[model samples]
Target: MVEVERLFFMGASQSSSSNSNGEVVFKTETPVQFSPTLVSQLADRQNASPVPTSERQSTLDDQIRAKIKDEVGKLRREEEAVQKQIHTALEKENLDRERDGAGELADGTDSGIGAVKSSAALMGDLEEIRGKIERFQVRKSLQDWPQVRESREKLVECYRSHKASSLECWKEVEGFKDSVRTLEKEYFKTLQ
Candidate 1:
């Protein structure tokens, strides 16, 4: 360790040390030490990298998830298209049947409304059936769609049997009747 002082020269050390017309001088030297733990930590973090397999698996999973989402969207679209076609076909069928029938103005209330005697019990039954189908409907395909078809037929029969005597009311309730068919179809489709 060597220090230089401007206030003192060679062989000059006393209460007032000086040099040739010297003033004062200061010396400062600081030593730095590297701790072992700190050095190890720095070396350990030299190359920061994630585990390769985990990263690779995450990438693979992302790709799979994207593919599945795309496939599900396509499937949903296809189902909707097929359903629309089926509904259109059903509508055409009903229209053809009506056209071929006798000259009926579609007013069942006149005489086709039948006896309104047990109408209360029948209405109660219909209401119960309606309760079984609120917000969700069962769906099925042609091969094993007997139950959905049965429910649909029964609903239509109920509508026809209890059709409003007034044409105006009948027209309005016809919307609800259409919903029944829709529910049946939707239910059957969901079942598949």
Candidate 2:
């Protein structure tokens, strides 16, 4: 704890007097004291040792390179394992084909990947698919457009008859619109 006192100056009193030169003398009071307080945290950055920028960056780069090399090695090992599995599967398939008395591959090659086919076989498969499609495909019945044709003819006749007053063909135009709407409804029903 600390004690505090304030000082102030005023005109000279009876105890205080002006100097010989007739200048008014100023008087000072006791010193002012403040209460003790908590100290604040301070950062002494000047005393700290900092790592060099290039060194920090190089360390980060080395870590990244090591991680990449590890990942590459792992991927290469996985690829080799997959290759081995594929070769084993191919061997099993060849054994099966031999037991089934099958001759060479359809493409005439005995490679690792054995699914290549001749153009002739591909054409034969396409023809077979086409035959099946034709056999099972739904044949669209002919949509007789008699109503639409009649309405269209009527509209054309009305236009021709009233070339100067085409507004007189409004009934025929409405008839044609109704016919088209009906045709669209029937088309959608067939789709469903």
Best candidate according to lDDT = 2
Write down the worst ten-residue block by lDDT for model 1: 108-117
lDDT of 1 by residue, 32-86 (tens): 7899999888878764654457889899899999999999999999999999999
Off by over 4 Å in 1: 1-52, 103-192
TM-scores of the models, in the order given: 0.29, 0.28
Off by over 4 Å in 2: 1-143
lDDT of 1: 0.64
**Model 2 C-alpha lDDT versus the unseen true structure:** 0.73
Candidate 1 residue 98 C-alpha distance from true site, Å: 0.2
